[model samples]
Target: MPTDVTYPILNAQRATELLEIAKSYDNDTAFPAAELKEIGVLLSQVIGDDKFVGSAEDVAPTADLLNAFMLLLICQEPTSPAAAQSALHIASLGALAGNPAITSRGFRLASRYYDALQDSEKAWAYAKKAAQAGDDAQLIKLQNIAEQKRAAEEALAAQQAQAAEAEETAELEPEEPEERERTGTLEEQLNELRDRLEIAKRENVKEHSEEFVDINRQVQLAAFSEEDSLPASPVGVAPNPSTALAKALSILLESAVGALWACPSFATRSHVANKSNEILRKYHLSPEYATLPAGMLARFYADAAGNNTDTTGETAADFYGLAAKEYSRSGNEARELEMLLRKVEVFLIDNDRDEAHDILASRYVNALKYTELPIAARWTVLFSETLRTEAENMFKSTQVLMDFLGRHPIASARSPLDFNALAEVFELLGDRYTSANDAVTAREKYRVAYELFNTANNQEALAALAKKA
Candidate 1:
């Protein structure tokens, strides 16, 4: 029933500020816990204002994300069963919205909650779900925590049972004074030490566990995938009224594609992506849409490619191939090259290095010869980063990076390049030099990286490498 005006305004900038506030909380540091909880309650009102199923689609995803964080803030302790239940509800919303990060957090929070309640089975199940949804690190952490909790609980229960048995046996047949005196004090001390050890172990687990993995920026990236490659609206001729239903369906498909691609568990959500592709294919094959622009079909294939989640990237590669052919047919050479680059990226993600390298060496080289500087620069950066991080060939990585810098100076790229990305490249260059024992050159690279991070006002990255600089 809520109108757009009635919905709470949680835009991207506001969302970023909220995420920073959540990340600032440290168990070791003093923070405004009560104030944050108060904010959470208000946000919860917005998230639960309607059955999330009926909430405004765009606002709901962000609101649910914030609500998950807020719930974590309030439910820091295991005793807050109610808050934990709320987290499960928020997680269900994540499933509905197809957001893996939010879903993973929600399930992990519930796992902690159930673990606190000594429900190991439920905790384990939720933890597994969290892992399946892309928070792979949480699964191991939760398992360790759960094992510790269960052991402590079992020890306490055994201690109580033994005490009761001893009391009953004493009523029937008392122990000798000398025997009791010899064992009583030592037994009590051992029990006390065991209790202290369990408490300390639990504390250690809590200390290592992060409140939430930072994923706000990742969600933003997924939400806007492929936005740059396509035209703002449909190109060529507009659809006639006779094809109105198919056009409406196509619009719906595009929205669904974006939502599904934003999910970190896009692989599990592939069924939805598959169905959307089927619907688009139906429209494309219809005689009523025989006049549909190849550019429009290309856009559909390109967007669909982003949502594809096959493990080997074969299906996604095919979609990109189809999109490239369509773009070529439409005479959009830039878009065709974009699709080819995307195909390379897909292979890179799948770690099909040979395939990715072949494409880069073959089709990409020929395509790059005719592309603009910015497009060519993007491919170079991608290849260099993959070599540095994924392949772990620091020498080759450095060579490629230096060559890129030589050709595309930072000054020339100030308008087009992402400062954080450029700063990271410099940071990696510093790391490469540091590994080679060239301290002087390394320091030079770090200094440039530091300056770039400063210019970008990226305080966290700056702090991380400040000592190196």
Candidate 2:
């Protein structure tokens, strides 16, 4: 039944004829190949089409005609992917024109198709839409199930809220849980990530809480004479009684002076510098009493005028290098990684995610093994920033990066990747293949993504991919 597509697709009579033939399929259960071609041509014509500016010469199919196609599709191949896809496109055309009939049938078709695939979440979505169109009993029943699921989800949310409140209020040790030592299989880790990625996307990871940022900012950085983060004393302090005593004295002085003098006063700059220098110099004279103190200050400026705004990003980049230095020097890997992550966070704020990623990808790849929930969460934030921001340019490499991250390795813990995040990754991969015209690979990715979460927006993409086979 394939027509000579050489018949000008833009010809008004051609569209009208195809619409008439499609609607009169009283005997057929499936559309003939020619009719499918006509339908496809219409879809192609409408892709990125300018909105209909109704005038005397408007040749496009009307809303009523689109609605008729929806009904025709439902009757012809209600459960087929192709028909559902066709219905989705045609129904959208009607909905744009505020046609109730087309909208109703479209939802009904979608609900039926998803239900056939045994995907309750998606089926429930369209069924709710169908019910909203009118008071259909079947639609109402399906809507009720969707409502019950929503209620259950809400209840789960409340429980999680309560648990979070408890955790926040609890007096807890800073160490990770004992179960963190157990790392599971790759499959298990992938499943964990799949679920996590879904939820993260649902909540929109782009807009997550900066709880770690606040924590890092508020943390008192360990001040050792060897720690380059703070202006250190010349003699490095070791784990000795005298060194410990010196560390204690330094902490006391920092709380009293260093913390207070975070913002250097112009009038007192020279005085404080002289005092600090003399204090450190005294350590050389009196070897027993080291004067290095606890540090909680960000000494950004070299002079009181604060002339260096770090406009070239060298200063930010140096912080990353110092963090690396601290990481190599400290035996406590967790603390050092946290300190490094804080620097990366600042890099992100400075709109330097590329630098942040480079530091993380190269210097801190080992941090991925960190089993602490808080630490894993930090990596998740970092990955989210880098992967999402660089997604368009580095999609292939982004996939490799995320894949290498594997799991958080915390026992019975959620994945580092949120469910939506993974779905998005796959979706993006699908797009990459599609752009390359690798239909087979693109369709496989699309199907997996669609199965993970059925989105109305991906309908045409899924359809287009399916048609290639």
Candidate 3:
């Protein structure tokens, strides 16, 4: 009896030793089915938390172990999908516990189980997780599966519908022989006519659609067809050459006046006006020539003499007034006002502050009296105010400046000067709020200052808080 018990113990020990050897081989190349089953039975018996099954680091042959365990679990008589899934899940967790490379393998196993069970939602969930975990292969596989499933469903529905129609047609066939044939023929003709009518209706609807305009435009392109022709220009005699030349010269003079008025750069303005006069002379027309047709002459000039001389403020203002009168005579009120504004701008640029202010104030007040012109006139007033504010920092009231900053936060937030101003205001507000010990208001002011500093990309200030922390 002692010998028999010793033999059984020795055999069990030998079997375990062989199992370990087989596992080593499986780890390197292939896992033998018989050996894995034997090892699984042994593992099921003695495996416990305290058995020193070894750490993940010790399990260098993790892939083999996982595969072997999965095979053993799946080969059970009443193989439970849930059990297989759980085994795969646990194995995957073990594989990915410390190894990022093996993480995708775990996710892939989970996906496979979910897919095998036809649980598409769970499969997609695993697939998305795997994709996020950096598994390109699994992501592509899941996408393909989804596309194929959709295509299959669509095809199946179409086939079923076709089959049902065929069956209906067959059932109605026998009743349509003699009298039915006559009626059926008429019906067939009518149906054919209806189909044609439907097609015509659809074509008409499509023709009237916005898409037709685009299609027509495309077909009309010269590049698309060699036979395409350009549209004819309107036929009219050229304007009297002298008059055309004079009008062009006048337009150029007006542009120069506008330029000088807007920015009071004398040399540039005189140069432009002189060039216009030269072009008029070259084309045989005078500066004061009337009855000039506008279209015959080009609106620009290249070169002219006498531009080097300095232009006085009065000269600029006079020229601008004359240009406005010429445009007004031609019924071009928009151009006339534009020229007037240019003159005002030139005056402002020339440091003729009183004249510039007078012009703007008079025009603005007059415009307000005309209710019909109020909206456009209001825009001009606003533009004038903006220009004035831009000219002199001393003219800007503190409240007005702050309101401007509030309205144009992006512009105000851009420059260091604006940021400094903002910070100063916040600091002052913070002091006022804190003197009364209003913590919330004080904190809000500080927060605004901090945000402004950050917006201005002051990294040093941002890091200062962290250092204190």
Q: What is the C-alpha lDDT of each candidate?
A: 0.58, 0.46, 0.44
lDDT of 3 at 212: 23
TM-score of each: 0.37, 0.32, 0.27
Candidate ranking under TM-score, highest first, comes to 1, 2, 3
Sort by lDDT, best first: what order?
1, 2, 3
TM-score of 3: 0.27
1-469 per-residue lDDT for model 1 (tens digits)? 3445544445545555555666566667666565466556545555554455244444444544455464455546646655676668657767776778778878887776777677878887888888788664455565445456666896679657656654554454421112111233323433433343344334543342111011111211222224411112343456553343433343334334333434343332344456556645555544434444668668767866755434456777878977888898899988888788888776554466656655554554545466665566556656666666566776776786677567556775463235665677787777677767675787799898898788878896776676355
Cα lDDT of model 3 by residue, 1-469, tens digit: 1212221211344454543654355245654667666655544433344231434432324433444455444444224564345435444544445554455655666676667777878776776666556553555566556556766896678657655644554454322112112234323433443343344335544343222222222222211123522222123434342332332333333333333333233333444455444434443333334344332121222111112242334445554655555566666555555556656654554466566656554564333333222233332434345444554422232333344335445343546645644544554444345444564665676677666666656665444322111
- Candidate 2 residue-wise lDDT at 271: 30
lDDT of 2: 0.46
TM-score, structure 2 vs. true? 0.32
> Per-candidate RMSD vs. true structure?
35.7, 20.5, 28.6
C-alpha lDDT of residue 261 in model 2? 36
List candidate 2 stretches off by more than 4 Å.
1-60, 63-324, 347-350, 387-406, 409-411, 414-469
**In model 3, where do residues sit more than 4 Å from their true spots?**
1-34, 41-47, 50-56, 81-97, 119-122, 163-469
lDDT for 122 in candidate 2 is 79
